[model samples]
Target: MSENRRAEVDAALADVDFEKFNYQVVFETTKGTIKMDLYPDVAPGHCKNIIGLTKIGFYDGIIFHRVIPDFVVQVGCPQGSGTGGPGYTIDAEFNNLPHETGILSMARTNDPNSAGSQFFICLGRVPHLDNQYTVFGKTSDAESEAVVLSIGDVETNHSDRPLEDVKITGSEVIVTEK
Candidate 1:
């Protein structure tokens, strides 16, 4: 199943001209809309994986499963828990990108190469995560950054799960000529 899904993703992205175009993922959530620009130059695999997932509606209706104040708001789990993925994992593409406010990075197990569909948006500067996680994108504007921080401020249980569901109602991958 994992391989099949991976093949599908690859086929979907086979015609993309990453160098001549820009890719962004716009997420419509219960809180508000947030747009993120992918850093394909730094993490092409992670960028492609996310774009592929979004294009296929993999993130629609997915809830933010984890939220940490002044840290990050996480989502993209199919089960609305921190344990599910899109059936496969991608290798880490750690780069020099700092994990500062509005930065988007992948969520994975202790294994460095275990990231799949799950990702998080930093609400504040998180230097410790720099070069540790794959930083593939970031909130495209101030409004988008504000929405992510607002989600981070939501009430949560001891486990960091949001008390009220913060869901991605829809998602779209926008490709524009550069």
Candidate 2:
């Protein structure tokens, strides 16, 4: 998509009701396309940011900043995994959204409102992360198994982890009427 077209979409979304921002992500990657339902009801702004970045191709070629085997697979940093975004930041928003199976959350530093363009998908149900990370969406168990299994390497620490076989081809938002 062109930058102008993406900007138009972003502007259009700014007027959309928070609840109406709900949609699903069809992530077409090297493994496959995984469709995940977004919970704007939980974190509208975070989900909106995700949709906006995706529309602008901000996540293309961006590595999965952090991928913990049998835990979670995170991506969405134009800076390359832990270092990418739209050159801006958003104040972190918290809600009742819990970190459960397929839950989506935003990545932020110790400083709140520091979220740029990094997000993460819960590979499994994580109860400890409840009320911490900014969840935006969750992956459907049956949407696309290839996505969750596309891990190409294993890292020992949070220091510059990468998924050699995965790349975000693109994402689409299917907003629903409030």
Candidate 3:
């Protein structure tokens, strides 16, 4: 990471009010359940958009189309081809959060504000993505991290698609008590 990028991340983290923000979600996938803590302060629109999608079962039946072992496990594309979304786009909410292990981030094209329903879970620290993508949430604990790793470890083909379908069975939004 560049010095400038680190500085920007530091500024963003300094303003976090951990006690007041408690948006969270639990995703039940074929591999296991993973819980993530959403950051509305850093990415309000993206957080709300994910919550809205969850409430309407938008992620159900979605497969982990792009799973790279020790890197990331991406899903949330209704088309299951890494080219679909919720028929809408949200502005990028890049924050101080680095793309570390268990981080939940929005996936987009070259356009910064092109993210929609597609997202990915970081399996390890990835510094190259800092300030380039919107990180709206992350695994809240060791248990959730383990689940994400398990999903990332699935056997993948040349294109990084899981050999066996790893689908999101269900998802729900929960207000965490700060």
Candidate 4:
């Protein structure tokens, strides 16, 4: 992400409330249920958008298309890859959330506002992304972080896209105490 672009996202979402907020995104994939822990206290705007999209079922059949080894597993589009989204944008809610393993966050293009309904689950701990991306949740298991990385990064001899099938069967919010 560019430094200028990062600044823009932060400026736009400066007013999002986070004092008493939380969210959970449960992705019911054909393989199994992948539940996401969303920290609105950290990324308020990002978490609000995620919950809104989930309630409307905007992520059905999406696949974990992009998976780089020791990086992250990107998903949350109707088509299942980073290539797909609601065709809109959300201002970057650049917060203090680190892109550590299992940290769920939004994905965007060079355009800081191009993050609509696409998100990713950090496969391994990538400390480099701290405050650069929005972190709304985390995984309950470190093992599952590897699972997302494996699923998204797996391909025939390292293709850019996944060669196998990954589907989100259902989606909903699962609330929990802070």
Candidate 5:
């Protein structure tokens, strides 16, 4: 991401009133649209990072680089591989959120604070991730949840890359009165 774009994202995030407004990110993917509700109260920084990135068109055309059956469907890697990010990182905000199906969490390296733009939506209960990853959001409705689960069921090679490309065609941030 460009420095100017990052600055614009920061400026926009600063104006948000989390207490009075609800934030959502609607992702248009090759499979279907998945709308996720952000939990700013539990993981404010993670929520802001995703919302900011979306507003800057950072997720457009990104592919779901990693998918594991009964696990997670990961995306937001600009390189269309699991090794890329938004050129910067955010500190972790681990909370008590359970890593159940439809839950959204940040993907990071061993360092908890290394999360950047990569994230995953759970396809089943992942108890090992509870309070380990930064859980910031979840599928907002049943339809969205179904889409995420379906994405997770896609066939992958040895590296977990989808046999067929599953790209995020576009993304949008939705803010509504709380």
Candidate 6:
């Protein structure tokens, strides 16, 4: 890591207050349940947007349209294609969070502000995505990590779409007691 990048990561880690700004995202998928711990202090806008969307059942029935072995599994587009959103766009909350295994980040086009409801989970370490995507959360436990791996390991086609559809049966924001 470059000095500047390491500094930014250190700062982000220091800024995160687990006692207050922490949140839990529970994604009940057709395969299994995947849960993550969200860090609002690092990417507040993106975190808030996802939590807001989850409250209204926005992700229910949404399919993981893109899945790549050893890369990422993506979802959150209402259209089930990669081009859908919540009829609005949120500003990019780029941070120093690394795209390591189990990390969840916003999926955007080349344009930073284009990130809407689409997001992805990293199956392995992807340093190239560091500071480029808004990483808001990560798998919080062994069970969630296992589920993420299972989803990422599924078979996919040439376009990285899974042969069988993996749907998000439900999504919820879990408030943990501090």
Q: Against the unseen true structure, what C-alpha lDDT does each candidate score?
A: 0.92, 0.66, 0.82, 0.67, 0.91, 0.82
Residue 108 displacement in candidate 5 (angstroms): 0.3
**Model 6 lDDT on a 0 to 1 scale:** 0.82
Off by over 4 Å in 6: 1-21
Winning candidate number (TM-score):
1
Expressed as tens digits, the lDDT of each residue in 75-116 for candidate 4 is 776654456666556788887767877788888887766787
Better of 5 and 6 by TM-score: 5
Tens-digit lDDT track of model 1 for 1-178: 3323676777778767798999999999999999999999999999999998888888999999999999999998888888888888999999999999999999999999999999999999999999899999999999999899899989999999999999999999999999
For 1-178, candidate 2 gives per-residue lDDT tens digits of: 1222335437746755664444666777766777777776667777677777666566666666677866677777665546556667777777777776566778888887888777777666777777777777777666464466554234445563762536777666666665
> What's the TM for model 3?
0.86
The RMSD (Cα, Å) of candidate 3 is 8.9
Ordering by TM-score: 1, 5, 6, 3, 2, 4
**Worst window of 10 by summed lDDT in candidate 4:** 1-10
TM-score of 5: 0.95
Please write out the lDDT profile of model 3 over residues 24-102, one tens digit for every residue.
Answer: 7889988788889988878887887777777667788889999988778999888789988776677888888899999
Candidate 2 achieves a global lDDT of 0.66
Clashes of each: 0, 12, 0, 6, 0, 0
* Deviating ranges (above 4 Å) for candidate 4: 1-22, 142-146, 149-153, 156-159, 176-178
What RMSD, rounded to one decimal, does every model reach?
A: 1.5, 4.1, 8.9, 6.6, 1.6, 9.0
Model 6 TM-score on a 0 to 1 scale: 0.87
The regions of model 2 sitting more than 4 angstroms off are 1-9, 12-22, 149-160, 176-178
